[model samples]
Target: MKRKSAKKTKTEKLGLIKNILLIILSFLISVALWFMGTFKDQTPVTRQLIDIPVTIVGENVLTDKNLYFNDIGDIKVNATIKGVSTAIFSVKIDEIVAVIDVSSYASGEYSVYPTLQNIGTAVTTTKIDSVDIVIEDIVTNQLDIALEVEGKPVRGYEARPDLAEYESTVSVTCKASIMEKIAGARIKVNVDGKRTAVTTTTNVELLDIDGNVINDPGIKLSVESVSVRLPISLIELN
Candidate 1:
């Protein structure tokens, strides 16, 4: 009877040890699963994008109303974005588009909000609350086109931009503010190294009264370019 009791006690001790081992293994597995779940890219992320282009919509409305844009603030925007890690990290700058609608607006300055497009399932907040857009009534003008020479001809050659014959006049159209800044319009010609005459079409350039180049997109020319006939001759020999 003493030996039987001893054997039973040994068996019970073995069973208790097995149960404890099983519990420990289960607990370790649960901890490992928790760690995998936490680190498996299921986290949320936030990021910022800069210089994303803003698409201007409904500008044709202004044209239909005989109006035009004198100035539009930055065409690019910066925004903060938020989403799941994979989606947010995969977002591209070009794929993001900010848009502003001016259809309901008239000829005046407006502070407007822009909406986002193409950023999938991501929430966005723009850095700027509003963008300023300046619209005005359109004006038209008819001006004779001429040539403005840049760069001297190569040594021993002479270029006569003045003698260049292009008799076609162009129609200039813009806002009143831009119209006031324009004095004349001419085609820019480069005479840097011309051994012969140039008979090609060139883009028209707008100039202020001081002969400084006026680079405003608001200035619209009826004809973008005009035909030219510049004469070149040998002036000296080296």
Candidate 2:
């Protein structure tokens, strides 16, 4: 009876050991499959991204020389990128920046090549189209600054410029073509419903030959603002 009991205990121990071995073998197989699936090389993908913005790097190079771009023809491009599927799909439109360096070039027209940046190493830029750009030299000019009063003063009051106290001259720098178009600079003062003299500082505006305001970002003025004193007086009715 004791020998039969011992034989039964040995059989139970063997069964338990076999079950544990099976479980360990299954776990190892699962781990190997996961590692193979996660670390395997993926197929390369090619994507054509369009209308990526072309930026001017070292724009200060031109600005410091008192020069500016007259025409940046076709300031955008289509990019062809080749990379692993995962990386190409994860890229954002804004993440790609196309830049053209004009630092070494002077004021003139030329065909420039643009380079891409911020794209990860997993991806490679295959192709980028070139662009034509024009840079122009800026010219300086001095013009007489005038003050114009807008809106009628309160009833029985007249507004006039205090010619004795104001900035009469302003120096302006801009492209030569633009400089030729500028007729003068003026500061506009509003005198609505005012019976007393109005004294304040206001921004000056560049005007074309026909008195239309010239709004050119490339234009630089020595003084951005000016002080004005609009002398008001009682109008004696005759």
Candidate 3:
């Protein structure tokens, strides 16, 4: 009985050793697989950025009456990259897009986002050093036009309509800079609702696209209203 018990003890010890060795071997194999996956190859990747929509809001635009605009869909920006095969495989195109916010711009010119900014120039240390991008505008029309007037007198009496830098119409539609001053604006006057020539001191308004008046809000006119000189006898008429 004593001999049998000793043999049993030896067998149990051997079994325990075998189990520990198997565990260690399995762990080593797992580590080797992980390392291999980290760096398997080196190659270039080309991905497409599809329909990345963005919105731009701007102020002081004219789009009413005869002027209008049609908003286009969100813009699309694409890029092609080259890098390590392992890193490239995990490189997500969507992740790259997550770094840019171009929704604050209006219908005009703008530069690409600088955060995920593609490498414009390549260096010797990196596989892919630059990125190229194409940006487009999404256009929309807003109906709020403001007309501004500007022009100085020849150098004498004040201007009647006060044409020295003021909004003509509440709004009009055109390019931003073009809306400042319009050409060929006129003002007509008729005394006593009759087509007669009369000179008097009165604050009248000018014409705008909305048919509003620019009163004599303290801004003096270099040229006064049209007038006709009258004789003393005519001035004393009953």
| lDDT: worst 10-residue window of model 1 | 121-130
Tell me the whole-model lDDT of each prediction, alpha carbons only.
0.80, 0.85, 0.38
Cα displacement (Å) at residue 213, model 1: 12
Score candidate 1 by TM-score against the native.
Answer: 0.48
Residue-level lDDT of model 2, residues 1-238, one tens digit each, is 9999999999999999999999999999999998876665376878998999888877788889877776565578988998887888888878788998887778778987688877788889888887888887889988898888889999999887764257878999888878888999998899999999888898989998799999988788989998877788898888
Worst ten in a row by lDDT for model 3: 227-236
Between candidates 1 and 2, which one is better according to TM-score? Answer: 2
Off by over 4 Å in 3: 1-10, 33-47, 53-76, 79-183, 188-238
Model 3 C-alpha lDDT per residue in residues 1-238, reported as the tens digit of each score:
9999999999999999999999999999999987776545533444444433333333223222222223334444444445555555565454453133334434444444433332222201122222223233322222222222234323332233322223222222343323332332333332322222233332223444566553423223333332322111112235
The top-ranked prediction according to TM-score is 2
Q: How accurate is candidate 2 locally (lDDT)?
A: 0.85
Please write out the lDDT profile of model 1 over residues 160-194, one tens digit for every residue: 87688885688988887889988988887787777
In angstroms, give how far residue 6 of model 2 lies from its true place.
59
Ranking the candidates on lDDT from highest down gives: 2, 1, 3
The alpha-carbon lDDT assigned to residue 32 of candidate 1 equals 97
